[model samples]
Target: MQVFVFDWTAYSENVDKFRENGKMIRLGKKHFNAKTAVDTYKNHAEAWQELERYGFDGVAINEHHGTPFGLGNSPNLMAAALSQLTERIKILVYANLLPIHEPLRLAEEIAMLDCMTGGRFICGVGRGAPREYKIFNVPMSESRGRFNEAFEVMRRAWTEDSFSFDGEFYKFDDVSIWPRPVQEPYPPIWVPLTGSKESIEWAAAHDAAITPGVFPGPMREDTIRYFAECQARYGRKVDPNKISIMVDCYVADSKEQAVDEYGSHLMYLFNTLLRYDQVWQEDVKKKGYYSSTAFEHLRNGAKGTLAEDDTVFNEWSMDTVRAAAENMPLGTADEIVERIIAECDDAGANNVLLVCNRGDIPHDMYLNQIRRIGEEVLPRLQAHNVTFVPHAQFEQAAS
Candidate 1:
């Protein structure tokens, strides 16, 4: 399968030293230094170049606003920087949250990036985090509708010379984006498929690529299968290479080494960084912001957890960490290769997104881990019928 690195650019330099006692992660800015944030941008660019040198098909970035969990408040900014840095690897912005953006502006920005990268950009779209919607003063209830409408505008803007749109969320009269994307039929659109059936169906209907994110157990595999099912209904071919599976990954000399170094950092992130702002959650609940299916899935995922607990540090245990790492390729090089292949075989996943660093892991450790995976795991993966097909090729095939 084609391999990608999902860089969170997590600001993990001094979190333990600065966090307020009993407060959740990303809650405050006591530890967040402006200088460090600037330094992180440099680090991310350097790391991406190293990943490209080590042989990754692409590097994916995501947007997270008002949180130190990810500094990519605007992933397009990172994409712009990387476009100048790297020449070969694909730049997958696994979504620019549509609800938070002006679609026409986003369309031109992406088109500019596509041209800058010589057609190496793959656009990924999503509804965004509920917390971000609140932070941006957007009503979460309109997320899906806004996302659908924005995507249509973006697509037409990329393809048409001059187009007018009248939609519920956006209206444009005879507007055209300059410097259309280099890729024919515009750069391919990928969707980050969480637990949204509607999103999965929509992606398939539009012949967009699907990247299934980390969910509880069989749900990830089930989601990929569901994508195939949706494609069948739409009479579209299911492309394994475009079906990406994202997982939390760390590898070292031994399983113990990997666990001891990365395990607690990972646990800290899931426990602290991933904890939705309680106020935001409550507001969403009061407003019924989530779709019924999305809400049900969230409820199911939080069952018996300390989602409501005040003691944030005590929220997770080794049991939970190990359970979460079960499906992940988290051991040595050999172990990682084995698990990855088996997973791709089971889920029909031909693309993988590896989150190589999180929390307070050292930069050297992250680079070393990526080096080993590249030297050992990637060569083996290449033998397994995995190759990236260009977005333009897919467009040509359809035409």
Candidate 2:
């Protein structure tokens, strides 16, 4: 099993000041303190360096724009810095928004990072969040078209000697990149799934790895099953090594102690930061950002309000957090190990991305959790191996 830490890189200072009427003021740049931002990045960089010392296999970062939710607006830049900062740990850009980027430029940037890291970079791409589309002034309806074309352009740029592409959103003539990727064809491509069937099919068609986004148990299982089915359609077998699960975790003396120490930070993430762009989801849905049946499998018999209303936001509370933690790996080290093993066993996923820092957790507290998990929980996870994928087996048996 491969264990990676997913750092949110949230801006923690004066969080309340950036909110108005219970909603985050997206234009609150006046409140931004230069020193605070600089120190935050410095602290996070130091923490990432410590991951190497703590025995973690890799560190994952992501991209977001014009929001305090994540400070990594340019994850590629951070990945470049990580290349020089650490020697052994893999750097995963848990993704770049494909639709908004110039495909060839991104291809070159990723290639450079791959070479800089000695082929340790994992190239993750996504259609991106609705807010990002708005940030880049891209029409939501054109997202899939742009993403498809951009990905092809990048793929061709990496593999072909000199290629010309004439697509709906991108065009090039006899272009060749200077530094090809160190990885044979290209660095591994991984997509973060948000229950979109289209995204799953696209990933499967490309034979790219996937990390089923954080969701409830049943939903996550359904996602894996659906992804397995899609893989089979492309005549590929499910590979557990390519399937990863993301989980928010905290470790302490007991479940109570863990909650006491980490509950507030977790709540701040859910109750505040996560909801900053909640309203945009509906607008994006109207503009065709999400498929009409995006989360259909997860809906079960309930009304399809998953896309219509942000129910997750309405239901978040400290009590809900504590109850959810029961099923999560947020307890003592022994309990965390047991729960994480069970989770991997249930999903048949071999890679786990643990998120210990969210909601602007204090730097010292974040480092402490990382050290604790690295010392007590990581070794056990690394030793345990998952041999089969249940979803793939079910799909094969049905076939």
Say which candidate scores most in lDDT: 2
Candidate 2 TM-score versus the reference? 0.95
Please list all clashing residue pairs in model 2, or write none if there are none: none
Candidate 1, 220: how far from true, in Å? 2.8
- Estimate the lDDT of model 1: 0.75
TM-score list, all predictions: 0.88, 0.95
What does candidate 2's lDDT look like per residue over 1-399, in tens digits?
999999968986747666678666665667788888899889999999999999899999999987778899999999999999999999999999999999999999999999999999999999887778877899998999999999999999999999999998899999999799999899999998777778878888999998874654566667777888888887888898998888778999999988888888887887777777554545666898776666666545222224434545554677978898888889899999998888888778899999998787999999999899999999999998988888768867787
Top model number, TM-score? 2
